[model samples]
Target: MKSLMQDVPLTLDVVLRRCLETGVGVEVVSATPAGTVRTTWGEIGRRATALTGVLDGLGVPAGGRVATFAWNTHRHVELFLGVPCAGRVVHGVNVRLTDDEILYQLRNAGDEVLFVDASLTDRLAELADRLPVRAVVVLDDGAPVNPVFADAPRYDALVEAVRETELVPRAKPDDAAWICYTSGTTGMPKGVVSSHLACVVHSLSSMTVDSHAVSREDVLLTVTPLFHVNAWGLAYTSALANAKLVLPGRDASGAHLAELIEAEHVTVGAAVPTVWVDLVGQPHRMDSMRRVLCGGAPATRSLLDAIARRGWAFHKGWGMTEMLPSGTMQVQPPDLDLDSPAGAITRVGKPSAGVRVRLVGPDGQVLPWDGRTTGELETSGPWVIRAYLDPDDDSNDTRFHDGWLRTGDLAVIHPDATVEIVDRVKDVIKSGGEWISSLALEQALAAHPGVAEVAVVAIPDDKWGERPAAAVVAADGLAPCAEELVKFLAERVPRWWLPERIVQVDALPLTTIGKPDKKALRARLSSPSRS
Candidate 1:
């Protein structure tokens, strides 16, 4: 009988002292390159307590690892609340990877203190002498500094030389705050980490009114990429819902996020689905947004009917980066049919609360969520990732098993537990033995009105040992015709899932985070002159 309450500690300094006592005058803005700046949540909680006295005068220790590589500004939301409320850990990094994946994630997260982003100091001055980082700082954004970080040190003069030092929070809701990594698209990128009670319970389960409800009269924006996964956490649920955050630095174009969501009347934006297909083809006035969220991929029901013809409210989520980036969220189930193509509007819905989700099969059994039983989705609770920070790594024997988290997608689940993902156990395709689904043939050829972008991928078919090959990209003056997108996927999928080759291209080799690389389109459709 160990009852009597009061166990406190879920840290990030209690979401930075409740966003500095209730968002003291809200607004955080930042479109920098020496431009929009702004700042508030009580001056970013006194510049994140002067960035924890510039990470304790750059010594950084207590669980170390800082690293930022900037962009989603307001000084990367003050190193996402001064490096995990000064107990230290932050990590972010991604800045569109490769420079050998940013020196293999700064030597696999031994990070230390790198900050950066004066227009990314000549790509971090060629890995600032192979960074195991101890002090680089920068952040300036008016560009022009990289004389190999001309004697480094200048995140606003080291937070104005520790702006009257006070630095309190020493963290500990199971410490190690945020590390992120995995866009290695099925390979190298690993490191997950999280905790500070799993980022304050995934920012109070993303302000739950069915997740991503995010409040304080919402105004968010984060075109996802505060070095990736955490941006998907919507910058800590817009600083624990004291909302109004914005930051579009490094122009996430589509007419600069439709003029920064119509000059910041931005009521909740989040990104991906290729930045909402370049903000549904630019040209402005965002009518104060009102819900967009989307996640790394799968949105195309003609980009959710071109973001429901701009009345916004898209919401397709489903996560990873080991699930600290969210687990599932599509919430629009009122007897479903948001223009049905087998509705549940691109289902990624159920399982956000403490996240459980199952569906195993291919013999390990545990399937039946019934909605036509496809399998391989597994997941598990309180902000997921129970492994992968290399403990004798072997990708923990194929991405963990007994404690769930295999999530190589390939979903379905439905009998009210919603889900529906449909492929990526290395992008599924089997063919003559019948499996198919390269994301349900790239969502039925992205609902073909002359397909703007698609992907599919699974080639090698001398007797159906594996068929399904697409690639597309048209829409804009339409030329569509690979037998009219296989007769528009022969009335939607399963004529042995169509496409034995479609091609078209003009762009669709993405993944530096904008996904759709399909392993570089199955090595450019298995070569020999694009097969």
Candidate 2:
């Protein structure tokens, strides 16, 4: 006989309902073009419920894709929950992407209703006649003059016209509730669709002590863009834990973030390493932060040391758009000495709960977790995606293998279950028939004390085939000469692995999401503009 148990569906609806019931006092603060606005979870729930009215009034079909091209504001937060709960899909367009990328995503996702911030309305205007969207709703109240979108309506008017109804989720747990596209550094962007069940499971897994450890009293500031992996799942984890959330809007500047952390007493936060590097240079207090989750790229020892000196905990995390974005959160062992060469705090930690990882060598065999053997990291779990949205895309074969995602990341797995990402498979430099880690070289260069930022790329060389070339951004008024940098690395790495060229740049080129744009850098080096 089969065992009898209630099969309650797991979905974002449950997460939202739980927050509304128990998190009445929790606050959702945001800085927008209209200035700062504060609202309670209860009020947000009411507004989110009201938003459904607008969706229904506009005749948004069930499971339709509703897109947002706005910042991390209170209104955008509404779409995060409202659209999905109303039986529609939420597609957050990365505002930082190129216009071509933006247009492609807008058309590819088949967005029906486009919601944009007043300040960002001009973006829609650029593609006004060409866009596939049926309607455009501006996210402001007309305080800042709105750009005419032909026949698009204002957000304030739409919300005011819709009457608040009893809140209820319309979609099933396994239905696709949100969509996000890859960075497409290698080619055109691929879309990833996440189910309601996956997001709910990720939220619970993220609350574990090894992850963000979200809790009722924790005040978390999101420096990560909401368009990026749902801001690394904090939007849901915060609600599930009843934690206060502070959104920095379009201004994630170091100065603004520092002020927000101090003013809001933010206890935990997440951002890329570049943002933290800027924060260290800013003259602002960060005593309120207890832990910060750093991702997007590897964290340098110099950056981590600066954070450690402030009595704050620094963590390195890793993820991808296809993994529902929760891969690993590094938690150092109690007995491990961080000062040792092997104790570098840069490891991306072990896989989060409910996730499994394996390493496969080029020979198609599973590698040992001895921390020495490196291979491509493959992952599979409840939240990890099995395939891309397009089946016809040729990347499917190389990206997914036997229900596992080929992460394209070269990494070593330690016996302690920790993971150290060596480099992207395409980014590993080969010289004299030996492989060199550009990431490791950049890490060593960042420790030079005078280097503010650095990116290591493989430049073509007739003698070595490809050699490591470092682009250095010197700190203000503390320029370390290229010769001094080479000498500094000579002590740390093999002499043959040294970068053949040290190109000094005022700033390193960055991708839309803030990571170093290595593709662009390589193109620049290959061009005839080097003087």
Candidate 3:
């Protein structure tokens, strides 16, 4: 029973060719310290081709890993397309990480060459003696080159020196194209490899109507860091959809982003909840914006209300490093009640096409979508990673079980197929044999008028085994009252779920990726001085 069909491989080459052919008028704009720089898709395609030639001249073997430590700019976009299309794996090192963490990733991944921005030379110089890379290249961004990188060749000079080579994708569909490490708040970061087939499929899925719905007419402002999960795949989606791509260089402040959106007429944007919170009060013309995608952390009701007041469509997305950066999307249903606590807009939405999700109990039984029961979430799909890059690692045993990636998220799936993430398995509070959701408590506290930010962590208690403790940041110039916060939560959550201790802080500790550092907060709360 053989069916007749073409065996064309799905790869980034296909995506690149389509982008250049149909995106004749499309442009990629990058904000620079000097001013805004713009280039057409045709020029980017040409530059990407030259970049492949540069790699060849540098003697980087096929399938070797190339590490990039730079901001989200046009040059970064070149590596994003050039490295993968030419069969080399592009590893975008998180620039926000500490020197030790950065060194660990470079050594763990066995990166051969390091491409860095001129402004970040000081950070690179600190680890220059210990770097495993064989060569270093600098991308000039109006910053003086550090003495350590003075001997390194400039990025533009290298690309311009190499003769333009024929543009052909050397890697197969199943070959590795990109590597992204998890944030690793609790432990060491693990590498996640994305295949060309997986990337192409995910990009297509992202452009579908129910997902991001990117199109040729849309101008996408990518506020997320390019080093994290491929900027949630927005860069690739923009190319495939022939949409205009805008990159806000090193500065992501509210004022800068507002100016870019209005000046570039950005129609769609994606970033974390923290970025959106910073943008709520920025006075700018954003009437052209059609949709805003938020992830990395849950959005509070206050933040959502603020966006609603601006008359902008807001969507909450759920994903992980294992799932190619996206799995579920929040799409409003026709019958959904906007004010209901369990509405579609409040949930993380249904599983995307080609992805399947289910909940599993502690005893290994699959849970039902009764809109009340909660358990660990598990997902399986073509794009999901079967295992981490290091096969010898012990964490792989618990991360993958029975062909499903254990998401480590405690969640409830409604009968309508929407998902409500309660808390992380390690972050949940265990009091008197009952489970309490830290995320639920934080969401309730964030709605308070005086509370600007909140984080809940489990504190050890002899009586209850583990009880909830909170750290809060006050809004504006007003100081928050602990008694008032307790009263506010008393009406929303169970009486037992209330935190045993609440401490006011200037700001919540954050991870490198901007999520609340619960592990650090737990350590701070458990300190003898705090006690």
Candidate 4:
């Protein structure tokens, strides 16, 4: 029988209240256009109270959704703490998404209120009637001004008179605290439903020195966009953990990101490998960043080695939106076969502290930990979401077996429990009955001196069902032919593993979340481009 004590208060507001008592007056620094700004947890708590009052004024109920289509800023961070803490769900929508897709998700999620940046007031206007928003609040650092809202209430004035209303949000541990939507390019982005218990459980599991390694003394710099899994779960963890948070404030460019890292003495930072790579490409070390958490795509060995040389530990963070994106951490293993060219650097260290990871074949057979056995990664833990908003879809039906969420990621688990992903399950190429690793190909090609960026996709081949083709960006003054690049990789990969064709370009298209747009690359192969 389950213990009654197990039903104890596990809601997010519980953590917020605890932090207010314990971590009050802790600095929350955010780099903004008006120079760096600083505030404390108490002020944030008060602001959250104000926000909750405003939410109430705007007709947001306990379960109603208050959407945020803004970048990472102090105001955005406030929503992270206050909205959910005040007992309302904040649907952090990805701003980079198309107008249509964004509106589709906004409607699908049935957002009742919106908190958007003044810059994106136009985005909200386009979806106004289509979306179910009852009010629209435009947030800014200065005196508030009304934006052109056709019907929704202007937010600045809504919360203007609010004096810290003690809005202690009510939420059961199992009640949904937040919701996140996937990039619907493949299909309509599935909204991931997570509970307060789930988010808190995942945070405890991820808080260890081995995982995200967050500490009160440390500062975290990120511009990964708050719309993505509550900024990949960093927003919630930082506030509840009392970690110094440095938001990149709308400018996630390489120069701006480097500046924040140096100015704030950012000890811990995270972004896609593309952003980090851009930082490394800069002439000098901006500041000594000790730890970097990278995901949104696999971190190639080449990129990892570059960070290592500069005394930075780039841990591979692998997770989907469903798990609150907290599943695996590839820290350097003790038995890392340093002799093996790949093990000299780190691996996704191990399944996050409390996460149980399993690789299984068809028919539900668990695979071995030999690292040679590759299978679909299935996981179930305190944080893993059980179902989607519309759980009837058959596409997502096969995503879970029993209670474990089939990650759709092809991975190998070493004896040490370190998870290394080779490629996405759907993207793995089969050519004439032979499996080709697109990840391995991309990693090898990224090592070449002249190659600035690369994306490999399987192209239709009549002889072989599909063959590998690469879309590559070359270094300045270097015009390497597809044949020449192929020869370069030939020396590294198996003859059959080499890409049959290559498309030279200046840049690779990327998903809104900063992943190399393999979907776009696959589109190009439909009509191969020539330099």
Best candidate, lDDT-wise?
3
Report the lDDT tens digits of candidate 3 across residue range 1-531: 997999778988877786567766789999876578898776677777777788888888899999999988888988888899888999999999998999999988889999999988988887899999999999988888899899899998987787755677688999999999999986899999999999999988999877878888899999888899989888888899889999999888888899899999998888888788888768786888878888888877667777777777776789998888888988643234456865533388888887899999999899999989998999999789999988887778989879999999999999989888888998988899998989889988887878777889999888999999999888777776888889889999999999988999987888877788888999999776753
* TM-score on alpha carbons, each prediction: 0.34, 0.96, 0.96, 0.92
Clashes of each: 1, 1, 0, 8
Predicted candidate 2 versus true structure: per-residue lDDT over 226-299, tens digit per residue: 89888888888988888899999888888998889889999988899889988776787777778878888877
Candidate 3 has its poorest 10 consecutive residues by lDDT at 331-340
lDDT comparing candidate 1 with the true structure: 0.80
Off by over 4 Å in 2: 1-4, 141-143, 332-337, 529-531
Error of 3 at 8 (Å): 2.3
Could you tell which candidate, 1 or 4, scores higher by TM-score?
Answer: 4
Which candidate number has the best TM-score?
3
The sequence of per-residue lDDT tens digits that candidate 1 reaches over residues 181-231 is: 887776788899888888788888889888888888888888788778778
Residue pairs clashing in model 1 are 424-427
Q: Residue 370, candidate 2: how far off, in angstroms?
A: 1.0
Candidate 2 vs. true structure, TM-score: 0.96
- Model 4, span 329-444: residue lDDT tens: 76643333434734633245578867788989867899998878888889988888677887676755777888889888888888878777877787889999989988888878
* Residue 54 of model 1, lDDT score: 78
Model 3, CA-based lDDT: 0.86
